[model samples]
Target: MKKNDIIITYGTHISKMVRMVLDKAELALSIPKNARIGIKPNLVVAKTHDSGATTSPLMVEALIQYLQEHGFYDIIILEGSWIGDDTKRAFSISGIEKVAEKYKVPLLDTKDDTYCKIQAGPIEMEISKTALDLDFIITMPVLKGHCQTKITGALKNFKGCLSDKEKRHFHTLGLHRPIAYLNTVLHPGFILMDGLCGDLDFEEGGNPVPMNRIVAGLDPVLIDSYVASAMGYEPDEIDYIKMAAELGVGSMDLEHANLMVLEKDTCPVKTIRSRKVQALAKAVTEKNACSACYANLIQALARLEERGLLSYYKKHPVCIGQTFRDQSGNSLGIGSCTCRFIHSVPGCPPATADILKGLLTGLNTK
Candidate 1:
């Protein structure tokens, strides 16, 4: 498929949908027979594919079957879940382990893999050696909402290839620039997006909205730009996408993209989910917060909102992020950086449940 070509197929049969798109795109023709291929999927959390936090194992299996059928056997599945989550557990719970076992393909958990320092543009980060060893990468990221970046797609999925330390560092570097730079270093040859169902607001995936389709493309920036527009935002709203385009990663010009839809009259009109995160974020006073920490706080606030307890934070406006370091505060703080705060739930990036518990306890005392 050409770099500017994007193919879409719609159906409930994920395996058939994947095979149809791959075949039509002629993705196999682009790879050499002896190439070491890595299938990177979004196992960001230990949730089933139905939960909308992960890529479908059925889709992965279909890709594997298609590759093997196309005489491509040097294939492996590799991924690392977000920090505070176990990759092994995610693989198992997400049904990807069984798919690997059935196909007799190796599953490399990048969390346990060694790293190599790579420099891209002005940013340098440690990427997994196993990921770097691959001749080509097929990124399968779930199209989802991100609390921090507003959206997550092809470019954001590459964060899984970074060491856990580098992942944290990316967040500290404000996420956007580092993410854009990471793609400049490790660009995937092909992208197959899981548009089946993705969480509407948070990356961790609790509230799912079903949009039964699969999107295939060669350009991450272009695909992400399309994703941003489809998800009710302008391409420029996502900083990394625009930065990656500027850094020569890929074009964000969707107008020139050759979009082809296979299935007839099945492309659902994109609908915008309520911006609950925007409303909930009013209670937060954040500065350079990491994705994980910010996500946990958002989920916690969502839970509080459900219980009609979110109002307790209007006056408090919970503080979080690196800038809170060495600063004393009277308001509730969410992470270890705000240790000087009178009320603090302390972890470098505290768990959602723990954040909720802390908020509940504070509410009771008040």
Candidate 2:
């Protein structure tokens, strides 16, 4: 599908923007009008009103109305919040339960099912048995800023579709790998973002920003790329989006994008969630800058960052491995006769000069 026609409509009354964004990309299809359809939304947390946190019920209602007008009304609004918060409770609180009643559809919370975990490569994800059993699925996500990934688009929203364990386990692979893998396996037939001025810095619990934009597309990766650009972030800054591009899940590059900026004034958004991180390769010659010393230094820095001691380290990937005069952590260490304490290190340590250079350049541009 060439551009898949991503629609980025503006304004706050979300449903209007949602309908405008989705009207063309997801056409009035004739595929079993009364099919058992599932509309997956980002009910990640329970918040009052739209608040630009989760998918607005009005946005889903708008889609339901669209489908109904097209003679397809049988559908189920399904979701399961991975966090301990009750998905059913969240649905009811978020106004989705009332939408289900009005639409005459079921609000199925997948957490209630006796599910089985399937090994998708080295990772196991808890998927909804009932949703998977559906004939049609529609991925409806609220476009927002993510702590790890710059923007949480349709793909990240799908992570909620899996069981709770799978969602938490993703942190094991550092948050990006498992996300990329999961997106490759399952994708929505159509993606409609409930953006219309969504989040920018944080997704569920952070203050909201008015992105006044609702985008829809077939390619989850491409949709994310658009959301990132709209948010003024370098698409490549988000590793998950990059991973999706590398896996051919979808393209992050917008040059080949057949995007239709519907009713947008082309506002330039800020590129946040980026910072400076670097590691130096030190030879055994210097003790002050040795591997252990660097470890302690980095550990202190990381601890400080974690406690909000340093705000600059947020969302920045640590780039390391330039050769220093210390050998405790060098590429294929020639003299490794000391320092028995070690946790995890990449196979090859990058040179100190390279790491510093990259960091300097990255920070200067920002």
Candidate 3:
């Protein structure tokens, strides 16, 4: 596969799939044999791959085996799970630790790695020192929906390389522009996406839709653009993908991309958009609500849907953020920014459980 091209191989035999793509792309010839390679995979939460929230261990193992075969031994598996989750726990739960042990490759938890400030375009963010020192970075991100960004792929996975403080700061910076800026500075050389089974609605994953395929590519922006299309969305729907393209990260123009399919597509693309999420989002009046706070609310609504309780508040809107500062009355509110509201759940970003409880009680009262 060429830089602008994407290859999709169908099946669960991850190792074989990895080998096929590497040979097809002749990716080894592009990198220095003795280069220090860093492999970053998404293990955002302490959950198994079956939960559709993390990268598959089999894929990572296959990548390690392929790289080792090509004489690349100075490889490290690195990741920093999202702020509130433990990276160690994610490694254990996602079964990546066993793969690391078998390959004799050290696992570097970026959560514990020291970071140094780096300027990427107009943005200056702290990135992991070890990540900065790598000769080549191979990104392995799960293709999944995101509450804030609409979707998370190759570019979004780089957030793991930042310190926990910087991760939070990205949210404060409104996520999209900062993400685009970060990629300008910290670009991954290659991307092998874990697309076997991914959640359709949330980044943290619960609903696993088995697509039974692995996607490989070199262009991060193009890869995300293709993923956005497969997941029933245009690339422009994801703000960062468009922003990154404008910043010259890569092209978001799928029409110009060289898309290659190695095997027949077993799982045809379906509209994975959840109606419950749509309805709940319609009830949300947000103005700069942070990703965590907004995601917690979405998760809470998902839980309510599971319990068949979503219909109760179908017509009720939830007010959040600084814009609703002195707002009150019938609408339920979330976060400390909505303190003046009578039914606000108080926290800078309320806990998921608390958000759930607030939804149940606040909506019931009305």
Candidate 4:
């Protein structure tokens, strides 16, 4: 909306989408015709675009061509995939090298960048040193579902800028929400979201859904809001969106902004979950169970509290195992009936009975 909120475009032709997005924005980015530009993309997993997993290289190269035409050169195609998959290998396998060769741009595997630690929000993170010296960083991220945060957009793409070792810690800090908090401080200069193909659930893990759409914007929150809309969910479903909004990141409610729906596009996409569900949300192994269960438990507790049935746990902090060190009262564990990880009604997570008991255990229901 307005001159800057978010630009939505449709098409597989990379150049056409870039031009359409910028045209819709109605503003020109005044970079030199021969300035140094870096094309940073979501090369996570190094999978092809059809997999709905990674950023499409065609889109990244498209930005390069657009920059070149507008008087830019000395460009570098940068990405840091993961541990086992080399960025160089992913670049070659995904045909990023071909695009780089065609454009004579350097292919940079950012894992080699000198590291710098920066503290923000509740966590301290390590980032690439190249960030300080870059003339401009053009971000291209695949719009997809994430098990932890719901959807990954411009902000999540910042994970690519960190070394693989640091990424492990990102998971440690509570996955999705922590990552969003981390990105708010490390702002990228420009962001062009690649939605040509995206996983409807779990950004990097879920099966790809064919949603041929792209959203571009300078505001990471705006881009995230668009991706949330595309996934058929509300912005509040994502914790970071709420946190970012509270942190004065940007508006999640884009309907109030300068939203210009293309005449060629549908009014809005149907909720993806309404269709055949492709994947189930599961917690990553790295997170302690407490941080993972805190939100849900809090919600359940609130409901119980409203019903005047939440007093048992006052004697002790309900410890859900590793999430915290020890509990002061009667601690109960829960496990899903269907999971092999479950031994019985009470296992590890926080069982329904335990919850009900907790709700009524200390309350004067009489």
Report the lDDT tens digits of candidate 3 across residue range 213-241.
68889999999987776554668988999
- lDDT (10s digit) by residue, model 2, range 89-207: 88988898898899898888877765557666567777778766777778888767677665788778877777777677887678788888787767677787776545544677444
Q: Write the per-residue lDDT of candidate 1 for residues 39-138, one digit (tens) a residue.
A: 9999999999867689999999999999999889999899989998999999999999999999999998998999999888777899999888889999
Which candidate number maximizes lDDT?
1
Candidate 4, which segments miss by more than 4 Å at Cα? 1-4, 26-35, 263-366
Badly placed stretches (over 4 Å) of model 1 are 265-366
Clashes of each: 0, 22, 0, 13
Model 3 regions lying over 4 Å from their true place: 266-366
Model 3 pairs in collision: none
Per-candidate local distance difference test:
0.84, 0.61, 0.81, 0.61
Q: Rank the candidates by lDDT, best first.
A: 1, 3, 2, 4
Q: What is the lDDT of residue 270 in candidate 2?
A: 26
Question: Cα deviation of 183 in candidate 2 (Å)?
Answer: 1.4
Predicted structure 2, TM vs. truth: 0.69
